[model samples]
Target: MERASRSNMQSILDYTDKDVRELHEQALENLREIGLVNPVDAFKALSAKDSKGRNTTLLEIREIYVSPNVGTEDRELSRIITLYPEITIEGGGQYSQLVLTFENNRFPDMNRIWQILESYGKESAEYRENIDDYPMLQLTILPLTLDGRYGFVMSSPIMWFLTPADPAEEQPRQIRMLIEPGGLQFVQDESYSVEKILEESRKMMASYKMDLQRQLDKEEAEKEMQREMEAEHKRFLESNVTNHTFGYDENTARTAENRRQAWNDMQKDGKFKVGNKRD
Candidate 1:
């Protein structure tokens, strides 16, 4: 008996192992069919380093012309160039706007400041409207930080005319900086950590298993309820049916007995015979 119990337990364990293996295989097939791969593996496959052990950097620039007036252009030009260390002046027509691009081996120190301006520009309606007149700068920078701890900043200068509430008042021009940061390696590092990804996957699998178990339990409960209902119906029929027949009720049995008795009385009265000769 002890050996038999041990064999049964081993069989159960084997069945569970088979089920787990099948589930994992099905999950892998689904991933392959959908062209989905582990994030870490995909990242590693595309990872590369340059000769300097850094990614290449690219800069995008745009010049927005808000109005024809050039009152503030000269005053703002000096300050804007001073703010950005890599700024280089270029000649432009009377109506043309100036834009500059710069690339360096080291990450720019003004990247943080540009990020702040970008955030502000996203929230400003004036800046958005000005962007419609001038295209936004879009660039991809390479040679990311060696330690994957740095980022890049790209921005464009915008000029708009600010008119006083009164029409007779002088119209003054205003200039605003629009900036955006890219290649945020530090944030990606935290989000793409192996431990974090594994934790998330485990949580997802646990939730799925819980949902499957709940569905199975619901189906089992429904089947048990149906069986109980069928049993109760059978007992009810047995109690109500006076005869051993399945469908006949007590009233039907009584009616059949009465009919038989009437036939017997008729035979005794000679109105009917059990076996009559037809001659």
Candidate 2:
């Protein structure tokens, strides 16, 4: 008989809108105490506007904490804020706790945003909890409409547990955030039709095929060069051996002829007798 499994499973916490709002506010306050004088003033300086030529408000804020052990300069946080014009600080303290607020309806491409963030430094993934049999959140990078602008949404998956004791009792949920590029607004009227989307897909495939062909051509050229080099090396070795054997054979033939002539000379001088005779 199989032994009973022994495992300790923690209960999942349920996160609500109020909880999220509280956290956001607390994080803002924390940054404010650190050194952020006026977050609103800084945001206004960016002059962020939506499609309707209206000013945008704070849509979301992400808090990034630096390690205490790391000896970072005072300007590092300022540099990070400046690097992303779309982001600003709430308050000032150390580089350890920097609050970044994004403008409303401004969503950037996920890959592009990640690249920019990675350039600044390493970051950790954010997760929230829910209580259900399936995942509470599902994250995806897809096109979406936000505040009258079309952009990409970067989403994260939320897992919900049906039973706290069972490891397999869970479901998936998704939360998404819009990312918009600078100065570009996606109008609903400009949305691609099915035929246009298909055409764009075909063009992308063609471009991909061209790139693949170029790579294959480069590899083939390298292989052909290697083959030529090998063939040349083989020819060189064969030529060297042939020349050495020719010289050796010529020397041996000359030596044998000289020995024959010397024998004939000895016989003519009668120094070496051909037949055995009594003295």
Candidate 3:
């Protein structure tokens, strides 16, 4: 079970509105590529238009928690998400929550239910700022694993967002996977127990963090190297330069002055005066 935001809870708490909007656009583009209906339309159609507490804009999938009962007798696969959506009220107009499921069959392409919580509001710029605010919906998938069993959730290091789709379209588009690490295939290593899976995830996260740190360190070193080079170059120029402009020594300056004086004297010569005359 992968709790959304591996860094997300932090991001949700820290991201500015502009940050949120950028992420929202990315998710929508991804969904469009896969032929998924515009999340905005799907969400609006399924939700009560005038109803309070609707996710009108910006939706971030917090986590994709899949519990594989690897060693236990109960092979139940538990997949849950916090803020799971609500189904539309029948006859009254069924439009409520936006649930994305992946089906393993040709039934409807995918049949797996993903519980998405409503928090983002583009018009209002609203979101669940509190990471712990579990409003309790259809799918409140949390991290879980069994003893000795192991599994891991492959998620984006950079959080993703869903927003109304339309650089030009009037409607909002939903769902996009942005800035994934190497665009690696999404996976959750199987585990016999929730503990094992959680442990595995932790291990993988630690490894990823180390790699990120190394990259940051390398960039810093490169910058430091460049600064040293620039400083050395500047110092060399400063020490080599003479007091006179263009690095001319006092002797060179006197020589140039002498040459100028000679030319002026020649210009004043009586024999050359007539030829030098101009209208």
Candidate 4:
């Protein structure tokens, strides 16, 4: 009986080892889903010093424009949206307004801020797993600078390759609107065209723009109120506090008297050398 049990265990091990090659390939696919695709490329893409690293490419993009200081005013610059007329597999996606803040506290009002994010997104887009299927994509440049480094975040709704690839015989369809939970699993509709996707993307962008406009309005109102309050305070001080009254004249007289006394004493002291002033 012990011999039979040993034989059974040996047979189980043999069966498990039968298709190691297929098992290895499946394991690699699973590993890719969890994100660790070309670790060397990913690491080099993120490295600030490695410009011409192995198996990696660098794309330099710069945004050149003048925007009104949103801390004070809003301009028509943010209203410009892109429809992506030339839609490449790697290039064209319906993107919302590219809102850039033009202010002095940040970079100068009209300086080209380098955008190296295309290379970053190209390498790192695979890691951005979808939280949900609802897509809201925008290329936003914030008015902020620190330690001479201005940066941007690579954002997308799916873990997609942003760079162009060799045209495939059949490309995967765009993510369709799921009416209910797990709707995608049950349905595979082929009706979602590029135009439809662009239309939906436009709507999403419009909604985002409205929300942003409201926020800008609120901020402008607050700034106006603050400026008014500051002006009022200045006016009040001007009316109430005269130079001759409120001890202002007395303080000035006392300071001048002390300085004059110091000068007289220094003049009398023959030993008051210039070197002594340092001490």
User: Which is the leading candidate under lDDT?
Assistant: 1
Predict model 2's lDDT versus the native.
0.30
Q: Global CA lDDT of candidate 1, please?
A: 0.32
lDDT of each residue in 1-279, candidate 4, tens digit only:
001111111111222222333333433443356353332322222222211211111111222232233453322122222221111111233432122221121221112121123333443444334322222232321111010011222233233222212245233222111112211111112343223333443554466456656766877787787777566544433443333233244444345444344434544664232322232
How much is the lDDT of residue 113 in candidate 3?
Answer: 23
Q: What is candidate 2's CA lDDT for residue 34?
A: 39
Clashes of 2: 31
TM-score of 3: 0.27
Task: Write one digit per residue (lDDT tens) for candidate 3, span 1-279.
Answer: 122223321212343445435434543453356353332333233332112232222122333322233453322222222112322211113222222221111111111121232221221133244332212111222212112111122233223344334465443233332333332221222333323333344454456456546766877787787777566544433442233224345454355454344334434553222221332
> lDDT (0-100) at residue 160 of candidate 4?
28
lDDT, each prediction: 0.32, 0.30, 0.31, 0.29
Q: Tell me the deviation in Å of residue 76 in model 1.
A: 47
Selected candidate, larger TM-score, 1 vs 4: 4
Query: After superposition, which runs of candidate 4 have C-alpha atoms over 4 Å from their true positions?
Result: 1-81, 84-190, 242-279
Each model's TM-score? 0.23, 0.24, 0.27, 0.25
User: Where in model 2 is the C-alpha error above 4 Å?
Assistant: 1-190, 241-279
User: For candidate 1, what is the TM-score?
Assistant: 0.23
User: Please, what are the lDDT tens digits per residue for candidate 1 over residues 1-279?
Assistant: 001111111111222334434433443443355353432322232223223332212122223333334453311110111112222122243222222222321222233224434543563435543343322332212112112212223334343222232455443221123232321121223223222322333454355446546766877787787777566544533453354433344465455554444444544566543222221
Off by over 4 Å in 1: 1-190, 242-249, 253-279
TM-score for candidate 2? 0.24
